[model samples]
Target chain A: MQKADALVPVSAYVARAALGRLAAEGSVKVSETEPDWAALVIRVRDHGDTQAFAALFRHFAPRVKAFLMKSGAGAALAEECAQDVMATLWQKAHLFDPARASVATWVFTIARNRRIDTLRKARRPEPEDLPWGPEPEPDQADAFELAEDTRRLGEALAQLPEKQRALIERAYFGDLSHTEIAAETGLPLGTIKSRIRLALDRLRQSMT
Target chain B: MTIRHHLTDALLMAYSAGQLPEAFSLVAATHISLCDECRARLSAFDAVGGTLIEDCDPAAMDEDSLTATLARLTGAPARPRQVDRPARGLFPAPLRDYVGGDLAAVKWRPVGLGVRQAILPTAPGGVARLLYIPAGQAVPDHGHRGTELTLVLQGAFRDESDRFGPGDLEVADQGVEHTPVAEADADCICLAATDAPLRFNSLLPRLAQPFLRM
Candidate 1:
C-alpha cells in the first residue's frame, strides 16, 4: 500500500502515507504541511497513533536492543527490555514533546526508564503507592539545532580534568552515588560534588 | 549557595547517565531545566557517555538478530498505557542540591530515633547492598563483610582516620572498623555501595535487619 506524491524524499513520502493510512484506521492523524516531522510524530503519539508508533518502533527497536545488550543484559533480558521500551514509546507517545527533547532523546529516556524499572522489579518487592514525578515541559527550539549544542557538549566533557572525568564516569557509568563514589575513590563527598559542579559550570561556559 | 546544599558532581553525573533513581532523576531534571550551568554540564557528561558507548566494542550479536527483532516488533501487540512515576516532593531542591539529587529519591524508612535506611534498587540480578545509618546521628562501630564504599553527601562525619565532608569518598576494606558520628549540629547523609552486608556488633541493629534491607 503506497501513495505516489513526492514533494520530499520517496522514503519520507512513503512513511508519511503509511502514517496517514494508519491514522485513517483510527490509529493516528497526520496534518499536511507540518514543518517539524519529529513534533508531528510526537503529536501523533499523543493522539494514540498506533501506526506512527509502529514506525517509530521500527526505527528505534534495533538500537534499543543493541543498547540493552551492550549494557550487560543477557540476550533474553535484552530482548525483553527492548520490546518493553518500544511498547512504552507507543503507550507514552503523548507524553513526548519535540521542543523539550529530540526523538532520540525521548526514545532513549523511555528505554532508560524501562531498563531501570526492569532492574527494580527484578530486585526488591514492589513498593505500594509510589509517587510519580512531574513531566518536563517542552522547549521551543528546533531538534536539529540541538545537535550542534550536543556536539559542543562532547568537547566540553572531554576537557574536564582527569580526576573529574574519572569521578564522573564512576558516578554516571558505574551508577554509584556521591557517597558510593567517595567510598570508591577515597575522596570527600563534598569534593566529588564540587568537582562535578565545577566541571558542569566549565562545560556550560565553554558551550556558551 | 551553600556548597553542602548542592548535589555532588558524581551524583549529577549519575543522573545524567540515567543511573540515578527515578525519583532523584526527576529532581535533577527539574534542577537542570532551571540551572543552565548544571544542564550544560550534564549534557557534556551525557556526551562522554555517548562516546563511551560508541567506543565500547559492540559485543557480537546473534546472526539475523536484527531481522528477528523487526519481525517481533511488527507482530507485537500495541502497548497499553501505563505511567511509571517517581516519588513526589520527596526531593525538594534543598535536599536534592545537597546530595546531587540522587539520595533525595530513596524511600527512607526510619530504623531508629532519627536513624533511617533507604535501600536503593540495584541493577538486574545485581547485589542488594543497602545504606544504613542515622538520619542525623552517628553510625555505630561496624565493619564490612565485603568491600564498602562511602561518599558523604551532606554535613560532616568523623571516623578514626579522617573527617569526611561533602563530596568526600571513603574506600574501606574489611580491615577497617570504625564508628562515624555526625557533627552535632548537622545531619549526616551518605551514599554507600557494598558487595556484602554490614556486620553490626550491636544486637539492636541486628534485630532491625529483617526490616532494613541494608
Candidate 2:
C-alpha cells in the first residue's frame, strides 16, 4: 500500500441511508431517467440485486465488446471476452472504490486485462491495492464528484480536434507502442492530462 | 524510502493502455508499488482510457447477450476482500507474486565479478531479471539498443548520470551509456528489464553477453 492517511470513519447513518434508497426503490429498472451507476453498484454489493447488475451489464457490456474489437479481437471472441469482463465485474464489485475510479474506468481495466490474456497471451502486472479501510462505501459527495469529473473528462475528449483526438484514441486502442508514443510529435495531450491530474488530487484528498 | 526518480508519462500511458511488453510491465508495476507519484499518474492515465471507452461508438450486442451474461452469473459471488496486511518485507506485492516470496527466495546464478542475476519468466519481446552487484563493484560499461528499465530494490547505485536509491527507476535508451557501480555502503539488488541486447563496450563482457542472457 502507499502512504496511509486518516481513515474514512464508518458511518452507520450513511449505510442505512443507502439501504433505505435500495428499499424505497423495491424493483429498480435500467432507465435513461435513472443512471446512478455508483449507487447501482452499491445495491449489487450490499444485496445481490440482479436488477442493478442487469442495468450495469446492459450499459457496459457492448462498450466493452467494442473496446475489445477495436484492439483487434474478432467479433465472436470480443463478445465472449466482454461477457467474462462483466462477470468479473460482478464478482469484484466489492473491490470497486467509487472515490478512486468511475465504474467506466474500472470496467476498462477489467476489459483491458482480459484483452491482454485472450488477445496477446500475456500477463498484466498490477500495482498493489491500497488498503481502503473497513468501509466498502465512500462518502456520497466524493462518489458524486468523481462521476462528475468523469463526465467532464469525456466531454473534453470529445471536444479535441480530429487529429489530436485520433492520436489519443490510437494510443489507447493499442495502435502505438511505447517507443512510438514517446516519439509522437506535437500531441495535444497536455490539457487532458491536467484535467485527469486534478481529478486524482481530489481523489487523494477525499481518501485522506 | 523516498523515491526521486519516476517513470515517464510515455511509459505510464503505454502501461495504462496495456501496450507494454510483459517485461516492461513488470518493471513498471514494481516501481508503482513503491512510488505513489507514479501510482497517481497511472490512475490518471487509466482515466484517459475510461474516457475513450465512454466516447467510443457503441456496437450492438446480440439480443440474448445480457440474458446470457446474467445466467453465467448464477453461482458467482463477490471475491472476498483481501485481508489488510501491514507492509512487512522488502519485496512489494507484485514482485512477491513473481518471486513467490521475499528476498530469501530468489534463485541467483553468478554472472561474473561477484555479480549474480535471476531471470523471471515472461512472454518474449523483452526480458526481466534481478541483478545483484556486490558493494563497490561496477557492472560492465554498456549502452542499450532499445529501452532499458532499472529499478533499485534493496540498495543504492550510481552511474555517470545519477545516483539511484531504493525505489528509484532509471529509464535508459540508445543514447545513454555508462557504468553503474554499487555504493560502498551495501550490496545493491535491482530489478532490470531490457528490450534489446545491450552493447557491451569491452570485449570480455561482449563475449559473455550471450550466456548472461541480458
Among these predictions, the greatest TM-score belongs to 2
Relative to the unseen true structure, what is the C-alpha lDDT of residue B169 in candidate 1, on a scale of 0 to 100? 53
- For model 2, how does the per-residue alpha-carbon lDDT over B128-148 read when each residue is reduced to its tens digit? 989999999997553457888
Candidate 1 residue B186 C-alpha distance from true site, Å: 6.4
Error of 2 at A165 (Å): 1.0
TM-score of each: 0.47, 0.82
Note the residue pairs that clash in candidate 2: none
**Residue by residue across A1-208, what tens digits does model 2's lDDT show?**
1111111111332343365467669754333454778787777776766666766776788899899899998899988998899888877878887776788898899999998888777899998776654454566776676677677777777787888878878888888877777524243344444544554555456667
Model 1: what TM-score? 0.47
Candidate 2 segments whose C-alpha is farther than 4 A from its true place = A1-34, A134-136, A183-208, B79-87, B198-214
Question: CA lDDT of A41 in candidate 1?
Answer: 61
Question: Which whole-number lDDT from 0 to 100 does residue A132 have in model 1?
Answer: 23
